[model samples]
Target: MAHAGTVSKHPEGFEDYVKRAKLSMPPEELQGELDYWRSRKVLQRMLDGGLITPDEFHKIDELNRKTFSPKLARLMA
Candidate 1:
C-alpha cells in the first residue's frame, strides 16, 4: 500500500524556515513573492510539457526582466 499526499523528503527545518521567512515579509511583498513563485511553477510545467520551447522560455524571461527592471530599480531606490 502507498500513502497518498505524503511528502517523503524535505530539508530539515524547512517548514520552520518558510514560516519565519513569511512572517518577516510585509503582506504585500509576501503576496507578490507567492504570485511570482506560482507563475514560475506554471511556466516550468509548460516548458516541460513541450508547450513552449526553451528559446521561447528564455525570450519570455528576458522580456520579463526588461519590463520589470525599471519598476524594481524604483522600488530599490
Candidate 2:
C-alpha cells in the first residue's frame, strides 16, 4: 500500500501555517521543509493525475510522515 498522492487544499489555513512555519525556521529546518515539499510534489503530481488508490496513497503518506519526522527533529534541534 504505497502510492503517490497530493494534499487537497485545506480551508483551515494549513497552507499559510506551513509557509509561515517554514519562514520562521532556522536554516537547517528550512532545508527540512524543502526536502519534505520536494517529496510531496512528487506525490502531488501522481494524485492530481488521478493515479493512485486511497489505500496506497494513505500508506505512502504515512511513510512520508515517518521518513520526515526524525529528519525534521534533528533540524529543529
Cα displacement (angstroms), candidate 1, residue 70, comes to 14
- Backbone clash tally for model 1? 0
Candidate 1 per-residue lDDT over residues 29-68, each given as its tens digit: 4434343343455666899999999898777755644543
TM-score of each: 0.50, 0.51
Q: How accurate is candidate 1 locally (lDDT)?
A: 0.48
Q: Mind giving the per-residue lDDT tens digits that candidate 2 earns over 11-39?
A: 34334546544545444444444455555
Q: Who wins the TM-score comparison?
A: 2
lDDT values, one for every candidate: 0.48, 0.53
Candidate 2 lDDT score at position 47? 79
- Tell me the spans in candidate 1 whose CA falls farther than 4 Å from its real position: 1-23, 62-77
Cα deviation at 32, candidate 1, in Å, is 0.7
